[model samples]
Target: MLDPLRLAVGTLTALPVSPPGRIDRRVAGRAMLLAPIAVVPLAVVAGVVLWAGHALGLPSLAVAGVAVGAVALGSRGLHLDGLADTADGLGASYDRERALDIMRRGDSGPTGVATLVLVLIVQCGAMAVAGPATGAAAVLAGRCVLSLCCARGVPSARPEGLGATVAGSVRIPLAVLVFLLAAGLSCLLPGLPWWRGPVAVAVAYAAAGLLLWRCTRRLGGITGDVLGACVETATAAALLALA
Candidate 1:
């Protein structure tokens, strides 16, 4: 359990932790499933930022931006880079090799830059309207998609890299169970309409599913970048629905 937790924290956040001694499918699967729990500290940071902003009478937009930035920093901006790379890959060309090559270059292009800007705007703006609790929920919602992405049978786009290591690591049942748990918890969060939490989650999943389908068709399968892209996409959709 501690090994899985350590793997999750080490991979998902910039927080310091001892690396797991072994990383097999079992450990990776458990780590992905534990993604939401692992990100709790980062979520708390976001919540605190929002709460502090409100208490200090700071501009909601500015505070929300800061909170989003804080999470990006906490996670080492891996998701944001993934989002950009995925966008670049999808927009680059229909040829799978060409698209993958573009993503491999590790530099943002016009399409990637534009996508990042638009997504960040959506995230920050949505956070401003959603308040502290919902904002934190949004953060967890982002990581929850990691389980779904790694569910058994989801192939990797490449033979190596983070995506290949974790791809198809999680069982489908386990992924569904995590989704249900996340939905239930979201619904139970205080101060929001009962429907809001579940609806937000549903929307996030729907958006992520669409992106996954597109990536499977376009890039051949999920990559590390694709997983990151899903995280950002789900986070934004969840926040928007909550707002």
Candidate 2:
């Protein structure tokens, strides 16, 4: 359990954690279950930064940029890489084989570059006018997509790699429980009205679900890139909804 938690935080965030040399599928799957644990600190930091920025009399737009910058720095832009790759893969080809090949090519295509820029713009813009709580809730809502992406029965696009091992990490019951808890917690974030918290979470879930379905049809299954895209998409959508 500790190993999964460590691996989850270590892999997802810039925070220091000594991960095990060998991570089995069970461990990887559990890592997904604990993914939200990794997100809490990032959300808190962003929220605090937003609050501090407001108190310091910084412009709301500047505060929004700083909040986005904080999470991007902390996450090492890991998920953004995925978003770019997935976009490149999907946009470059209609054939599954070719799309998957393009994704692994490690070069950003026009689509990937364009999407990355656009999504970042949307996220930053939304966070700009959002309250501290809304900023925090948006972060949590985005992270909540992790549970859905790693839920049981989701298949990997490839036979091996990060996606295969982490696919179906948590069973439906546990995933559902996590989603509910995360959803409930999201409401506590300040910018949005009481009802918007669940709405924000739903936006993330809808984004994740939409990505999963599209990837399954286009790429044959989910890849690490796809998962990355899921988080990025959810983050954008949740922030917009919350904003």
Candidate 3:
């Protein structure tokens, strides 16, 4: 249990944590399932920043932007990098090998840059309208989608890196359970109508699933970058739905 927790935190955020003593599919599965829980520190930090921004009478959009930036910093911008790489992969030549090569590159291209800018804008705008509680919920929902990405039938696009370590490691039942629990809890988000929470979660998953399907078709399967793209996409969608 502790190893799973450590793996989740160590991978998902910049927060310091000891690496798990051993890592196999079982550990990776549990880590993906625990992603939301492990990211609680990051979420809490975002919540505090959002609260403080409002308390100081800052412009809601500006505050939301700061909060979003804070989360990116907390995660060491790994997800954002993933998002950019995924975008570049998708927009690159349709040849699977070529696209994968582009995604594996260290630099971002024009398409990746544009996609990142648009997604961040949407995230910040929606967060401004959704308020602090929903903002935090959106962030958690973002990570919760990772479990779904690792469900048993999913395959890794490549045989190495973080993707292969966790891809297809999660049991379908466990992944579905994590997703359902996240959706159910969304109904409890403060200041939101009961319907909005679940709807927001649903919207988030739908957006992520679309991306998952596209990536699977275009790139042969999921990669670490695809997982990151799903997180950011779901976060933006959830915030939009809540707003």
Question: How do the residues 112-180 of candidate 3 rate in per-residue lDDT, one tens digit apiece?
Answer: 999999999999988887677888999999999999899888889999988899989999898889878
Quote model 1's TM-score.
0.98
Report, for every candidate in turn, its global Cα lDDT versus the true structure: 0.93, 0.85, 0.91
Worst 10 residues of 2 by lDDT: 185-194
- Model 2's TM-score against the true structure: 0.95
Instruction: Please say which candidate is ahead in lDDT: 1 or 2.
Output: 1
Measured with C-alpha atoms, the lDDT of residue 185 in candidate 2 is: 75
| Residue pairs with backbone atoms closer than 3 Å in model 2 (clashes) | 29-169, 133-189, 133-190, 134-191
User: How close is every model to the real structure, measured as TM-score?
Assistant: 0.98, 0.95, 0.98
Q: How displaced is residue 190 in candidate 1, in Å? A: 2.1
Query: Alpha carbon lDDT of residue 232, candidate 2?
Result: 84
The whole-model C-alpha lDDT of candidate 1 against the native structure comes to 0.93
| lDDT winner | 1
Tens-place lDDT digits, model 1, residues 30-126: 9999999999999999999999999999999999999999999999999999999999999989999999999989999999999999999999999
Instruction: Output the better candidate (2/3) by TM-score.
Output: 3
